[model samples]
Target: MPPISPNELSDEQRPFDEHVRQVMGGLRTPFTSTDESGALIGPFPVMLRFPGLARPLLEWFTTVTSGSVLSPRVREVAILTTGSRYGAAYELYSHSRIAAKIGLPDGVVAGLTAGQRPAGLTPEESVAHDVAAHLYTGAPLPGALYRSAVACFGECGTAELVFLIAQYAAISMVLNAYDVPLPPDAE
Candidate 1:
């Protein structure tokens, strides 16, 4: 059972004021747009219970997913790696589609789902995969791995990689502990 029932308050039932609009507005993705009539779904409705916390979480998530130093593909790779490691079912379900929408390779997603490093990753993807794997597996980053990641991603990008790992790890914990499920009709 879900740890918390999703907030079912309609937009009209809730404030739906300018602040809510702005916060929700910032959460759009290429595949998910809140401007559309029915696009506010997934963890969002669940988060409505705590607007104060949700505001910054949504804002930061938007910035990380959209404006981070990491490429969208790399970001999704790290997310998928963490989601798979934790067996966060909702994370996998949601991010798999996002990964495909962002043009991560089919084989790569498949590999991540199966907890294996998929073949045919670009050099950048490989670095992300390796970094995520090291963190998820609780292994130290070997000197060569660290140097290569720094070389590929630069210092800031490398730092963001670690941050993304930690962030997604927390996200997975929330989804798993709360038993967040795939949205209705999602396969």
Candidate 2:
């Protein structure tokens, strides 16, 4: 159960804040609405309590997750690594599904879930995984690891990777803080 419940507002009672509207709109792509009430599930309902933070965070999350220079395969690898390092179950579960959906190799997802570096990654995927592992372990990236990330991703892509790590970490914090439970039917 989430520590906070979603605001049970109807359309007529929606808050009149433009930022809230923008955040709500941004959520559609990544989340499915509930069947009867059409409410967004996941961190959103918890976030909506503070519309100011919700707007910018959700917008940036959408951009990085959807339009980054990193391939979806590469992005999901870094995300699931963070999820695994933190034992952030929601992140792991959701992104594992996404990883498979986008055709990430099964060995990669399985290795990540077990907190080991999987075999058979492309060179670029390996660099991304290394970076996430270093960050999540509370250690600085070795000079070689940093250089490898820059080489694989370029400077801008590398910067985006850092942002992606931080964003997912924030999400994990929210989910853990709220003790957000997975839906009963989640696999």
Q: Tell me the TM-score of each prediction against the true structure.
A: 0.77, 0.82
Best-fitting candidate, scored by lDDT: 2
How does residue 174 of candidate 1 score in lDDT?
67
Candidate 1: 10-residue stretch with minimal lDDT? 27-36
lDDT of 1 by residue, 3-122 (tens): 222254556425533454466456443333232344345455545556666666656665665557888898888889888999987778778888988898888998997778898788
**Model 2: per-residue Cα lDDT over 42-155, one tens digit each:** 665566555566667777886776667998889988999888888777677778877888888888898987788899888998899989889987788899999999999999
User: Which lDDT values do the candidates have, in the order given?
Assistant: 0.72, 0.74
**RMSD values, in order shown:** 4.3, 3.7
Error of 2 at 154 (Å): 0.5
